[model samples]
Target: VPPGEFIPVAERFGIASRLDRWIIRTALSRHGAALRSGALTLGFNLSAQTLSDPQLWDFVDNVIEETGAPHSGIGFEITETAAVTNFDAAEQFVRKARERRCRVSLDDFGAGMSSFEYLRRFPVDTIKIDGSFIEHITQSRFDREIVLAITSIARSLGCDVVGEKIEQQDTLAMLSDMGVAFGQGFLLHRPEPLERIV
Candidate 1:
């Protein structure tokens, strides 16, 4: 899992730019080794602060070179709020990442009212349907509709959709019925040490 506290530290220290580089370098070092062993690609969560940095591209270039990891082997996950707040810069970053063959995903989709608009603006390759909606799929028709809407939009945009926080077998079956392309949750796989995963 991505370190949850790193972004807060970067913001508090006013060195978010440097922290972004450090994240890329540190994450790639471990993830690159995994790639070499033919493991699944690693995903990194991008902080909103990092998304706005003009120098982020430079950092990305340096890390990619240092790690010798294919752009396709790296996926960046940015929250919906972050993407909308930094829409223009995020769009450019997404475009550039795509050019480098890196995949971009809109994380926490459907958290706010403007998610669809954000999706229209950014060319993301994946949309991770927020857990709030996924968790209550059976309890509320509205939640199911929201997920369905996201699924339809993703399909139309030619993007894969991943459902998160799937805790029950029935929930997994519901999501499968909706034809979600991927999913992640304890029910599917829990986090284990790297050595244990293999």
Candidate 2:
């Protein structure tokens, strides 16, 4: 199932942090070799519930020490919605993660009304433009304008912009023109099993 369907339930049940821990441990253990060798840099999506957990970092440290994954190869992604929901905890988590040299990305950025305000507070390494906006960017002048504004502001903040859900050549061309350094979608490659990816 897509995480969107289940993550909220997990959060409401207060099991999201445990689930996040398991995901981090499993990904690191399974991909430890590639991560330690600097051949792969994996980003894990963190839930708001997980971010607020005080022991989250301790759990992360133990797992990373166990797996021997370099801090540089470990990354975390917090959704704009989640970040806005718990701003204080999110800010704290980002700061601590950054101190450990782990990259943090604000995913689905611009999907929230207070994105700019939160962006000013969260020291994210990247801002992933929401897929909703990218879906019809080529056909919507409004979408284009939003993307341009987000890209420009992200540039000023020295944060990378990653376009998501790109499905057509036109979308890729447009993103490239706008200087989006990275993007992820079916146009690039479809999702596959971790075994295949590794």
Candidate 3:
């Protein structure tokens, strides 16, 4: 199925929890060897609904125990909007994940409303500046300002900032100058089949 179709279908069928389980299970099953060997680390995106589900954490704990892979090898990315929508649950999820030594990142950090407030509350290790703010950042004064502000806030909060959709050298250079810790986009690397790496 196309990636876009999976969420709606899962929600409509009331199988979102099952879908989350399947995703985690699949990741562990597919990458168990590499993860155990310290050859690869895996990251997964958790939807707002999943973040609100404590059962998901239980499932993750079980997987960690079964695989014997270091919890630090797994990271979870939660979008700003999603985390803010259910702040309490997201906070709990973040704290619990951290307790297990898993890294948590706030994705699309500056795209949503009250991002700074969320940043203050969410104990994430990284914040990914929204791609909308990163695209054409060098040319658009507003975007550059937003990215700089987000980067500043992230830095103050002791979180690494990442610039997304950085498709130009000028933009990358601009982000580097702004103290962005990392960047992602076509200019750096394109998404490819995971099997290629495995």
lDDT of each: 0.83, 0.90, 0.83
- Residues 91-142, model 1: lDDT tens digits: 8888888898888998988887788777877788999999999998988999
What lDDT score is found at residue 170 in candidate 2?
92
Query: Which parts of model 2 have CA positions greater than 4 angstroms off?
Result: none
Q: Which model scores highest in lDDT? A: 2
Question: Which lDDT tens digits does candidate 2 get at residues 1-198?
Answer: 887799989989989988999999999999989998888999999988888888889999999999899888999999876776678989999999999999999888888788887788888899999999999998899999999999999999999999999999999999999889899999998988877876
| Worst 10-residue lDDT window, candidate 2 | 79-88
> At residue 174, what lDDT does model 2 achieve?
95
* All candidates in order of TM-score, best leading: 2, 3, 1
Top of the candidates by TM-score: 2
In model 3, pairs of residues that clash are none
* Total backbone collisions, model 2: 0
Q: After superposition, how far is residue 17 of candidate 2 from its true place, in Å?
A: 1.2
lDDT of 1 at 169: 92
